[model samples]
Target chain A: MKYLKNAATLTFDPDRCTGCRRCVEVCPHCVFEMHDGKARITDKDRCMECGACALNCEFGAISVGSGVGCAAAIIRSMITGGEPTCDCGAASSGAKTTDCC
Target chain B: MINLSSVKKKEDCCCTPQKNKNFLARTPEITGQAVKSLSNITRERPEWVTGILNTRSGLVPIVTTEWTRTDRIGQIRSRLGGYRMNYSVRPGLYAVGAPDSSSDVFISANYKLSFDILRRALRGISGWILVLDTRGINVWCAAGKGTFGTDELARRILGVNLAGLVSHRRIIVPQLGAAGVRASVIKKQTGFHVHFGPVDAKDIQAYIRAGYHATPEMREIGFTILRRLVLVPIELNQALRKSAAAALVILIIFGLQPSGILFKSAWTGGRPFLLFCLISIITGAAITPILLPFIPVRSFALKGWLAGAAAMAPLVTLTPLGGTSALLDAAALIFFPLMSSYLALQFTGSTTFTTISGVKKELRIWLPVYIAGLAISIVIIILYKLQSWRII
Candidate 1:
């Protein structure tokens, strides 16, 4: 399913793309496509900004502000004051398991 | 004693002296029986661990592809939102079949479901499973949160002395984990080349058979009807919990007759309100997700609102509230749709495609509208109550 239009933070620089196709392979949303021996952003809005592309890119061709998109987590962070996380009580207790969404 | 010292010497060359000491300390009763020695040295194993395989690194726990009755029960419990976070396996190295040092190493998250699915997919395959500590989260969510990340992968690789356990330099990581793990950085840190496998564990065998090449379909994440249906139980559970408190508040508010509290008024006036709450819950948490693609709107909140409106329309016309007070009917229509909208918006967390930026934008615009609608509805309810009481 799609979400808000033009809201994704994903950006790509074709000049730095080595056309390794790693970004095209890793993106869960199929946001990247290869054309003329170079990777291109075919569906920028479809990007969830999970940073899979940027992390896998060896030539520094991609950038995005990646994070969890849960509103409950964001609301919790506003109250608890920290990075948005769904780890519930585990974050404070230094526990390995969490009872969260 | 001679063999112990020889093993120690080999370990010293591969890992730190402290780690070697810790390993020796954990295995105080190591004996001469090669097969039993490794298992005996390891501490108490979990129930799922059927046996131990003697490997170059040490004794690794062996797990079967078959699911135990307990495993199936736990899966159902977690799906129903019972002890979801607690359903996790201990993170470490495990063995499938009779894998030797030359076997391929597959990496996974410590979440029990994720680990189970992977092992199940490996049915007849013999391989080494390297599970990373992701605080009991699934691979995709853990990767997004950066727990199934580069540092952890590298650290786990060294901590287990993986190089000593495997002949090849290649380790197969789940493709979804690419969000947090940088293969290039992992190679530089651990000297093991990261080869991303298919997004789904079921495709792993096919991927290996195709010379480690994942077709485009295997790489793409699919939000099938089955997947969406499985998530509904948890969503419905959470929505019901919140709705309980809301129902109580509604009953109390309607029960207030300016004559302290009246059960008669609560039973009569609050019935419609309670029904509205139930309808909103189902619309937002259940129907919205199940019919996500078929829904006309792209924004989840709007879809929920529309669905809520459609469901409430029949109730509004059929119920006594329609004839008694126009104001109360208007309030019910406005407030319940907004409630459904808010609930639907929360589903962005469970979805695969929503982005942080997109959800933030949705909240910026829709949250204020929801708040405003709620305020207006409450005011209308108060006005209708006062009119009936003849106070205004």
Candidate 2:
């Protein structure tokens, strides 16, 4: 959190959460908890933004900006001017973007 | 029952083909059912995957102690072959030693390096190694990728018939893999207790001997000089691969400068830019990684720019051919720093420091500036090279 002084992008709503406990299961950081059958943000700062919980959440109840934190992915996104997942400048093959200029 | 077709076949392995000699050697204790179950799993096979052991609980895939030529080569390739190099073993419950139902079941990713380290550490110890399908990613990265998550772990346990094999209910997982795996959910759904071990595999033996309590040293992750240096090769290799074509193109373009596109002008004109590019690549990839912890900057890009500047200082000071063109000098000044910054930014994902949001935020703020700088320099250099514009 030294460099990332901003808040964790994770947001959870009890009403939206089905209490399936998927987020609690998928989150290695233990950032979320189960209380009264709803997922609760126990330690928001512990969240490393891996996006595992968000991807595994079936109910669309969980919302977190992708926490891939992949520097290559981020650099690729900037180079391509497209989704961060694309491999523009990345070593892998992906759709090359003309926006490198 | 899980659709395992998504897992790759042994023939599809990317490493050089070794006569299609795909086979798993089983110990005498291995049950026919266990052997069949293991052979059914067709993923990237590690050379250490021996066969099965008839443990008290059920069946566990046996990992060989004798490190083979494949492991030796795989280790070297993984070190120098960049982040994309994935030598994964099939995901299953593996036996590290003479394990039984009562032995500890440690879970890890399918990345062979991680698997090898775990098996190596538990040399004399008898235990179970439950490898999750992580698409050949390491434990930490796979956790981030969700391939080592609750679902996959649960699925693997069930798929391997782990309940029938082990008497213990607790599963020891890597601390770094906790991001993707939720202990509460596993306990709730699979009824298997999840226990996170120390962050490093080298400390696992000590951690286990100490009854699962981790020292602060075990818990801490350091960006040591040696660790930084090892990653340099892969980064350097990747940069060279991507830039070689560009280097050739630039050499030809610069050769186009003079009527003789021969060695005469090649040395005089084209070679200078190529040297600039190679220097940029080496400085960005090699020097930056080596000096990562020592670089006096908060941002990775800034650190890289500084490294490039440091590299360029000696080159500019030592060389005497500066009076020929102001454009090349200007290009070198701007381009090297830009390249270094871009390359250094790539390491953000791999480093222990820096957060995802932090990188994203940095990209939002600084990327435009770097790209703009690169664009302007390239434009000016190209214009000068074409003789359309001169520095007034």
**Candidate-wise lDDT, in order:** 0.82, 0.68
Output the number of the TM-score-best candidate. 1
Judge candidate 2 at residue B379 and give its lDDT. 88
TM for every model, in the order presented, reads: 0.90, 0.75
> Which digits, one per residue and each the tens of the lDDT, describe model 1 over residues B146-263?
8899999999999888988888999999999999899999999999998999999999999999999998899888788888899988888988987789998898888998778898
TM-score of chain B taken alone, candidate 1 = 0.90
lDDT of residue B269 for candidate 1: 82
Task: Estimate the TM-score for candidate 1.
Answer: 0.90
Per-residue lDDT of B4 in model 2? 31
Q: Candidate 2: where is the Cα deviation over 4 Å?
A: A1-66, A78-83, A86-101, B1-51, B55-59, B65-69, B82-86, B258-263, B386-392
Q: DockQ of every model listed? A: 0.60, 0.20
Q: What does candidate 2's lDDT look like per residue over B1-392, in tens digits?
A: 11133322222222112222243223333334334444554343445756544443333456776677877777888776643344667777777766767889899888888888888878788888888878676787667656678899888877666676777788888877766787777877777887777778888889889987666567645668877777778777777888979787777666654455665665567666777778878888788778776776667778788888777756755686344666777777787777877777776666664567878877886688787887988787777767622333
Worst window of 10 by summed lDDT in candidate 2 chain B: B12-21
Error of 2 at A28 (Å): 11
